[model samples]
Target: MGEGGKRKSRQEEVPAPPSHRILTADELGLLKVSEVPAGDKWEETAAKQRWGLPDKAQGITRLQVHCPDWDPDRCLVAAARSSGRVTLHAGSDGGDVGSFRAAPPASTSGRSDTSTNAVQALRFSQPEGSTQLLISAATLGGHVSVHRCPVEAALATAAAGRAVHTWEEAARLQTISDLQAMDVSSSGRYLAVGGDGHQLKVWDLEVAGKAAMASTTSSAGPDGAAAAAPKAGEPLFAGKAGKPSRSGLQDLAHVTALAFVPGQDDKQVLVGTAKHKLWLYDMRAGRKPQAELVWGEGRITTLQPVADGSRIWVGNGRGHVEALDLRQAPAKLSMGHALKGVAGSIRALALHPSEPLIASVSLDRHLRVHHSTKRSSLAKLYLKQALTGVAWLPPLPAAAAAEGAKEDEEEQARAEAEEVDAAEEEEQQDAGRVARGKGKHSGRDQQAGGGSRGQHGKKKDSKRRKQ
Candidate 1:
């Protein structure tokens, strides 16, 4: 036993771990970097303080922002704290729209099971052709709950009365343990979830949404015995089921990251494991993974598939972010666009739904926003707090993006205005001075020569008469 009553490891006797210097934006050759302002001014730029973790509990664990590409306005950004506190921020500027606690599902396991330490996974989904968004939060205790949030209705309620309720419980999902990660599809048809021991399970959210709708109409069972209300944390698969992909490897590593492949009608997904490898699966085929690609090192944290499906961007620990093309026979990887000069492991990566930007938060407390198209560093900001995760706030309408662009352009124009054209100014002054000089000379010549002109004319007449 060492100093604290525990066995000391040999590595602990050695020197401390080497620390890598965090690079500046200029040193990293980055552009358009925005740093959090000193004091309370930071509240104007980022919402860290506005949605911060309470001073009492552990820090924030996860964050998810709603990005509605269409004209949707209700659900904006939400933050989940370590003490099971969830706050929803809505509107253009992310404000506290709603806050709720994920109380342990009653009768789940037993009455004694009351609460979980923190929210393990948080996801926000908007079903197709639906006015409300479904929010799913899973706890470490394997209890998951889904809630329906109505943005406009909440605002209307606030206007009518003092108290405004933005969201309500939609459905509760059965408890699943060690849920490492989860993702919802773009079409909002399916949900891909994975974690320790449990493999990938894709739930048909459309079916779940329909069930939620049906439950509203029939409050009682046909026998009139008063139907058992759907448990707040009921297993979604128990009623509306989803297909699971087969990965033949029984000795599977913990699933640390998950992404639904695009342009496949939601039939394919890419799963990243803790073994520093990637396994691609096709839901339409057998359970075994279709392809496996090995990265050099580091635990995979996030995956982003390109629109064309030709390349996939993978971010991992040790600050390694690179693109991989699985089409080639050997799964050719690209070193051209890798994010360099990044220290610390990436905790989360979020890509803008409509814009060419990808946001990444790492252990270094830096939130890096990169250009997705060029794969270059656009901006990097340090929010002071140790960031655990990040996600893009749901996109506003085209007009809002356009307005933001307009504001940027106006600022650029103002900056350009400050750089006056010195050459042009000098040229204009010289021209004015020349014009004034000519005017003065002309006036003097006209007055002095006007009287002499008569005398000269008389002399000319006398000379002509003499001749």
Candidate 2:
């Protein structure tokens, strides 16, 4: 607005771009589901489809999807209702995947009248690279269950694996009240679990058993050397989530999600919270978030690190999706929104491994595709159904390009690091004013800006210029 109409006219004189075309049904690529029978329910009006039913269901608390690979067709979807029952479906395209009843032990359920226990979250882990293991965390019982995909399928083979076989894993270190969110690294090496209690737990199983997944964070012995193998059944490390606290939610805001940078030796984990905050913890560096990504907003529900680990995609409750490139210094930090003014909370987002496109879903029943080539709208999908999750298909086999991938990642990391450093430098100067006692608390108050909270939370590129 400050630049005014003079700037607008100057821009208009350049050229008027053509209006964007909204693809017709025939023109848009088909969204096909081979496993489940196709139905119009997802694209129907309220009278035809049960819109808002899931949100209205007081008994249901959380929804989770379990896809072994990147393929959406060969996946399993599960929703945990407050009624203590978990419904699992094979696909939107054919047969029922399986429905399993998960409840407190028989001895425990007799003590309570609640029919459905609120399940907080669920995640899939593929440690040791065998079959996928599904895990569930619930509120009241503080229980976690692990089920192997093939094992569950074999058991259901008699019934088509439509029968869920849930096995109780070792009791989780923390209860639901302590839990905030959970994530399994892409390689299935470590399970990062964080909660309102301010601690992030890194469960390492590289030496736990025959199905151990190698950890990239693991290093050779002393002074840049290799270390010995861990005991056969013990975890390499149960790295803490955050500093310990007496009370979980009261002491710390609940954690919402955790994401690890893909294809990196450093175990850098991105953690998001309900307070619209993001922090980065380098497992190789410290137990707590050493760096933070700050951009003022309301509560954040989702955090996804781009493949390179230098950039992060975040979604907040107010329907804002932003890409925080972490390379710039604190003094010169810049932010760009992929989409703004969305209808509902941006709850789920999926990033393409190789492309600049990002797919985001909102509870308001919208799905949008954003292009990373600046704040441009590549396409928007108006689904008749509210979207709960979205996973972009990975690049096809024929699309493999190793050299291109390496170059892209390096460039992205360098750019993000520069931005983060610039922002950090500016914040440091602000912090300096207070340290000199000129104004004791003015700089601290400036932290309300969000991204300025931590100066060195991100890296910096060598060429970043100072003002």
Candidate 3:
């Protein structure tokens, strides 16, 4: 700074602070980024940017996607939260489309318990060649309710002051004491329920509907009074509890998850238990399980069968997700390739509709996508909260896809223009540096020329003095 007798800048004179400062625990916690490791920072940022902020209340408990036949262009995704709320999101962009309360209204005379009101299971069904969508929701208190709404009108928004089309309660029933798993048959005619009581019960919805209709009809009794109505919650088939000598207990193991095999006309159901066992039951056969498979990992948590009914995916409590070949004999059913890289228990697993891809959510706060055939990780997103459920949204419509492609092309063009502008600016800077270097050399040459002239003048003066 003192080489040319110029004053030093204040910034240069003062020393800079250290690059990094130590933070306290409270400070780090307040930032909320402390839990994210350096290697996962990019994934965390990407997930947040795509899905927005994590929910402030309880996390999501279940996810279901429905694509109606009447309107093939629009798809809806239902998310059941632990806070006893069910919300619908647009499958295309994951935007909140609508929401409706799943739990019944609380009683005026008694306090309501939130834990008992939480939804334990959810399923969507549509009858063949029908325009209505049936949504079944099961609560922890063993109450199951089915609601119906027109599939085409489900996604339409209402005017500012008008009422919107909403789901109407079709039927309600009471099942086991602590309902844990439920599945509706593909035809929307049968429902299966199981819980902590180790009892599996199947209900014929067609029969229940007929009974409800008959009860509504006015009938004369023997004493000129109306006849009594029959119970609508009675199950058509109920499995008996296992003997004490079988498991050293009076009851069989509790069911934790349930899935019906696809392409089988819903005749076969897969039941998973807390005892690390898988049970295959045929509806035509007796209540006994036709086959059983013991898993090596922790208890089974979720089950999903592929479309062709060739294989089934099982997620366990030990963070292992494996596929089992269903074509093999029940006694010889062996585990297929297992998806890796999960550190926590998988809470849910979903297969893509058309692609050979599978998605899973785990207690590790991650949503991972894996290839079904290669069993390799395709993508991983680090959500801030522990993920409980994940489902694939339907593909975008053709018109929407084309519009998105056009927008992407515009964005690409804009980025290329910006790059070209930056390159030109850099080239100008290089030219300016060359010009400045030439000016400096010219100044030095002029000074040297003046020195040479002065030397010549001194020599001439010496010669004149000698003369």
Candidate 4:
């Protein structure tokens, strides 16, 4: 009851009640699936739509940004629909930015691949020392398209026309079947693409960057370097996600998820397959997978490396999360702790860069975000559609992050200082006890000497009496 309590505002006096919005079954039924209508009456339009269920979320990405105008709590999510279209959604109330169709290229093999419009995967990559955001999308057809989007321009266009940049490929990495999983190296030096046809392709970034740079100089576009065929550098090497762990070497299965090990020069990768087996594929260590992590259960839907590559967060089709430590042997990888998830198969999982928060999506049409270390649920958003993929934005800056948490460095320093003081106090106490023990022993010795002298005097007195 100090100055803060005496204030008339009473803002901090009473804990603010949790604010919630109530939506009827009807209101919850329809959310705007299309563009923001003219005059922008859609906040009501979404509430009034007839269709109860919404379009499925097949793919999603968050446009990375660091600015003062943007709200730190709000996130921008772009969801790809089954209709071969991509929509930029700004949170629950953040109106749709815009939508654009991702057209597939005409097949060169004569047979037509019309499934190109169905975007199977969506990801954003920003190479080191670059400001432009590169969005890569892979469709059901063997097509991967990279779009160079500027944050200001994309959002401006999205606000003005309710549509963002028209996606044009900066570099094309064609696969045999629909690409299932793709990851760019931390350094943006390599790109790994895995697909349904058991095809694994790695693209060298230096060569691709030069190619992208040349193309940009000629046409002015942003690009992601490490994810495709050898247009300029290393030739595309093919491998498999197949074969038993003990059966020597064979091809690979349909790769469902991918993760690049984190390091300045970490070359190893963790590949999750339809067979529920995790493979450590190291290109530098020969063609065979470096190790295989198998548990013999659900298909791996998403993978996230944490604890600086020593730990990995694995989500399966069964809607469960497994925390696996890969530093152990492959057999030990099966020993993992489980985290509760959605009721259905998990489609994607995105771990926070600095925090223990992990955002995940499920076929159950919900975004379940949980704390990795605390074994607790954080937020659950029932996205109206069945979600297929999810991406979390990069970690916030130190100053912005401070709002959500106290400075860990300060805490660590205080703890260390307390430990040192405690140790010093303990040593001082031991020395004091030793000194007291010596003093007691000296007193006992003096008492013993006095007793001997008294005995001698008593004997002399008895002799004098006898005389």
Candidate 5:
């Protein structure tokens, strides 16, 4: 083939660049519901049927994303329902992958039970240099169970009404009652739980694992057979109560949210309480909180920290979301502006993995996205059910990922071009200054020479006149 034909072939081989821009907070404000892609919106009824959930199944209570850094290809989102069931979804498309019951069914034998065994929290952990994924689920009944399964097996297709794998329960904790919050450290070594009992507890999973193994080996029978051993373990660190009030009564400091500070090696934690208090505790420094801050009047509901642990976004029960800078001596609101558009109590808050966007679900049944910098409402969608949790699915789809890459390339190119232009402009300005300086010096020299020559001529003429 000739050169022109070969060039044409090469051009055809290259895929066309996507005709879309990276989604921004400003653009989100102008977006309409109809303009939203069909795949982006979740149809409640259709989703129920697709997931084989009963028509009257409870709404989603919690959402957790499992995106391990070791394996970027493995991204999964788990949504726990109020009915004690947790359903896994493909992080790329929000498609239902599998479901499992996290809590046992409630008794129906005329028991005057006021509280349901709904899942209060869910966390996903994959230890470093490990192939298995651990899912920690905490129910209101005080049972915190950690289940383990291979990543591939958990994501594999299973028969309808069955889990992808028979995930083995690796550990269990029945210490805290009415558990309202729970978190697993990034290292997968510590598990924290807190609730109405006004106590914060942390468990060392490494110790628990060793204890479980030792118990299993010791319990072996004469035939060298041993049954599955109980993995329940006590908390390695338990926080104590605060000082008494002026009325000589202890405060009802209900623990609502817990988060491990990043970069602290899972040794420091930030706890949110129902009494409008935020406490920072260092596990190595004893049981008392090292620092505390009071923000608004509402009960604290959620806490999300930046990657470096410099700041945290705190959500309260009065529909307020504020970012507090931890670097401050007494951690104060950093954003200056609070996230708006949430009309009811915020149920959950999720930070975007790559964007400066904050996703929040409220009791008003709306999912709102706000700009992290501007703290302005970007987009808002109304779902029919009472919104409980919201999370950003990671490992975006191929088309979206490619589009994002193109946007990043374009942005980088623009930035480089701007820098070059700025440097050239600065150089030109310096050249003009040098040229002007030379001209000024030449003019001064000419003036001086003319004055000297004129003075000499006048002196000679005066001498000649005298002669």
Candidate 6:
């Protein structure tokens, strides 16, 4: 019935709905805080190509450096250089203060070979209320070594006593399966090892209440079918076989990095793969991953779970560093932009436990510090060589947290005050409106009644007189 085959409405025409889009910039007080610029040579600091090096100098083609938990004092720092020797450096004032050298791990044939081998990973275990120890592992021919913290410190204390006390080798070059990455638990109770063609293996260093390891041999079932059981009560700490954690037969795809989520009851463990996936397992539960995080096109080379288990930080071979909020669903997660120019895979990342900072090392021979929360560059150091490891100093006395009860009480009081003020203001306005409305209605009613009464009196008087 309409002009162009359009149906006519039976009711009156209605106006179109109003647009609901707001296109104005919010007037937030955005203060551009002054930033500490990277050093003028900062660009060069990240450069790997260096000239003018003596041939005999062995210009650090590959190096693995470890920074202890973000403490200001008594932090352990060590590096394995290209000269087939591991160096221990005392990190003080945010720089190297002293240095010492230890002989490389013995070869498989029980021969000490000082040939050039890359240290694949370095980890430090300083459990709460326990002494600190440094653990470093070299690749090319699996060599794992552990040294007490004081041995090097004692030598550094007495430089005149040139007799450099050698580190007590814990595990030698007996291959742990050509692993690319290793992680030591902060509690010093477990060590997670992973590498090429192997499932993640966690070694219990304190098994049976002593410093011991499981035997490195094939296990047998009752039927002698070569069951993959850890040897007896305390199996060998060699091989890819171990008592599987909650994530059974982890069977990773070329593990690239491993880390632990500390300060949690579950003590969740994270293993990253060269296939660009990360598996999160709850060690307290079973042998399967509780969750998985996948990112980027390249292998995820590093994973650093923050002090709390709710957030995770990962670096991949494609030069991407992303922050993941585990509380969100996989589809609704938060992420930061990729740190550009970061190349050759991020071999290591360390978060400052007390500060909003992160330290990262790459196979590209650069050490960069980023603000973890803002995802901004803070500082960078160029070692002119590939970096295999990194860590932040342990927490300092200045890192003490605010008193919980005091902070909670203050927040509660402020919230209560705001609520009370809002409620009182609402009550006052409501009472004023109610009073005005009552007075106006009452006056109108009185006027109406008076006019009716006057009319009625006039009519009654006139009718009576006429009667």
lDDT of each: 0.59, 0.50, 0.67, 0.57, 0.68, 0.52
TM-score of candidate 6 to 2 decimals: 0.54
- Which 10 residues in a row give candidate 5 its minimum summed lDDT? 25-34
Error of 3 at 141 (Å): 0.9
Tell me the lDDT of model 4 at 348.
65
Clashes (N, CA, C under 3 Å) per candidate: 10, 56, 0, 8, 0, 22
List the pairs of residues colliding in candidate 3. Answer: none
Query: Which scores greater on TM-score, model 3 or model 4?
Result: 3
- Please give the range of 10 consecutive residues that has the lowest summed lDDT in model 1: 18-27
Model 3 is weakest, by summed lDDT over 10 consecutive residues, at 22-31
Candidate 4, residues 1-467, lDDT tens digits: the string is: 78866786653333321111111111122332221122322232221112224423333322222222333234345555555665655432335555555545444557764555566666656676775656666666645556666655453522334543454445654444667777767665567778776656677755655664565355532564333232333434555554554657554468888877775264677788887888777677666676776754888888878847778888887777877787763445554666654557876666655567676767777666666787667556565654555544322343433431243346667989999999999999999999999999999999999999999999999999999
Worst 10 residues of 4 by lDDT: 18-27
Give the root-mean-square deviation of each candidate in angstroms: 24.1, 28.3, 17.2, 24.6, 23.4, 28.8
Rank all candidate structures by their TM-score, best first, as comma-separated numbers: 3, 5, 1, 4, 6, 2
Q: What is candidate 1's local distance difference test score?
A: 0.59
Per-residue lDDT tens digits for candidate 6, residues 225-268, read 42221232322233332234486754444777777776554255
* Residue 391's lDDT in candidate 3: 64
Task: Let me know the TM-score candidate 5 reaches against the reference structure.
Answer: 0.66
Candidate 3 or 2, higher lDDT = 3
lDDT of 4 at 139: 68
lDDT rank, highest first?
5, 3, 1, 4, 6, 2
lDDT of 4: 0.57
Query: What would the TM-scores of all predictions be?
Result: 0.60, 0.54, 0.68, 0.59, 0.66, 0.54
> Which parts of model 1 have CA positions greater than 4 angstroms off?
1-58, 69-75, 106-117, 154-163, 205-250, 306-311, 326-336, 393-467
**Alpha carbon deviation, residue 80, candidate 3 (Å):** 1.6
